[model samples]
Target: MNAPAIPMIFSAHRRTLRLTRARHRSAGSDAARFIAEDMIEDTLERLAFLRHEPARALVLGDSTGTLVASLREQGAAVEEPAALDLEAPHPSGGYELIVVFGLLDAVNDLPGALIHLRNALAPGGLVMTHFVGGQSLPALRAAMFAAEPDRPAARIHPLVDPRAAPGLLQRAGWKDPVVDTHTLTVRYASLDRLVADLRDQGLGNALAKPAAPLGKTALARARAAFAARADADGKTAETFEIITLTGRRSLAGT
Candidate 1:
């Protein structure tokens, strides 16, 4: 798995495992798929503005092919990125619409990855992406920080900043890029369940050098501390800051 330039993110190959698991164990089934589905539907709607059906479409980081299946159901041809070489240059323009979801946060070389995606698109083609980033899990982060203050090597999963989206796209030769964000809050019956869900979701803390595995004493301490911060209803709050991005490359220009 390629390490992303951004610290603490999962590797590309491992992301599928994470998302698939997350999707499966998602406590709020509806909310779990909300972001991914919303991104796909929105991207499709935007591509409709182009006034023609794209003959070739590419879907990046399409683990389990939910989006790919949707596109195929729409009668569009789809190519998935997880099966390709992340370092390879994008193939000559063949796709008119390219949608990458939940991947930017994990790829080791985001700019390089975007450039490849850009190269695969036909002139004037559009590329849309949604990724987990930008202070998405502040509460969880805060708890971790409180649990271990001196663990600088400890890293949680890395997320992209919405503010960095435009620059990243530009560096990849994507013009007229637009990036925005939204927040999602998820709940857990208990701090323990929440942590379990995170692990099942493949969002296991990937800190560069996390503290020693949580033994019974440490685990109890962390849990008690987390519960102390729980809301009146007794549910722990988890935030996910999602970033939505869109960009285009001129015909034969990129």
Candidate 2:
């Protein structure tokens, strides 16, 4: 029997467009990059702790280029592909280490993507993947809801849940899989600023069916809703939960 089809919720083209726009917006050194920086730091720390150095590595979705530079500094030959589709099989394989940043959250067939990543690795090779988790962006979510209280649209891309990652890794045939999560809290004075930060970090929505842009009245409502959550200092706290998944292909090449 044929397997069930994965839901077509995200558009690969839209995802690419969002990333491209984010790259353009975040080109300057002064742009917001807390998310990418955090992921890179955690990944380097893990690699150091494991003492697993790879001769050849593939780094994906590293918009800031810092991760690639760091890996090269570590004496690894890194491949930073211009474009890669996670939902499909990687063009090449036999990589010793694969690091994916911030792209997995928008993948529609996440399980399949994991399998592809695993397949692309050589025996005993390591893969570290990080993306925003399901618990992220509560403030933005609330504001979007307020924009259309009577009929809310899908304004945010659904993210991966940390709880489900281990199962996905196991199903993908990864050995000794690990799932870790950490939250980053940022205070924003307004909803527009929060949205700008997200765009700067390539966290914009990439749903296949994007909601229409909010009208003037709706924008005011969203701003008000977000402001209502502010503290005495008039800044709203927003949380971004980052989930990291690490695993290795079996030595037996399973």
Per-residue lDDT of model 2, residues 20-44, tens digit only? 8767877886788899889999998
TM-score, each model? 0.79, 0.98
- Model 2 TM-score on a 0 to 1 scale: 0.98
Give me the overall lDDT of model 1.
0.68
How many angstroms is residue 29 displaced in model 2 relative to the true structure, after the best TM-score fit? 3.4
Model 1 lDDT per residue over 1-254, tens place: 98645543434446555665655555454333555555666666666775546668877655435768867877888776444545567654578888876656666667788888788778888778877786877766666665665553355766677777878888888878888787778876666666665554445553334457655755566677677778899887888787888888887756
Q: Output the worst ten-in-a-row residue range by lDDT, candidate 1.
A: 201-210
What are the lDDT scores of the predictions, listed in order?
0.68, 0.91
- How big is the positional error of residue 40 in model 2, measured in Å on the Cα after superposition? 0.4
Give the C-alpha lDDT of model 2.
0.91
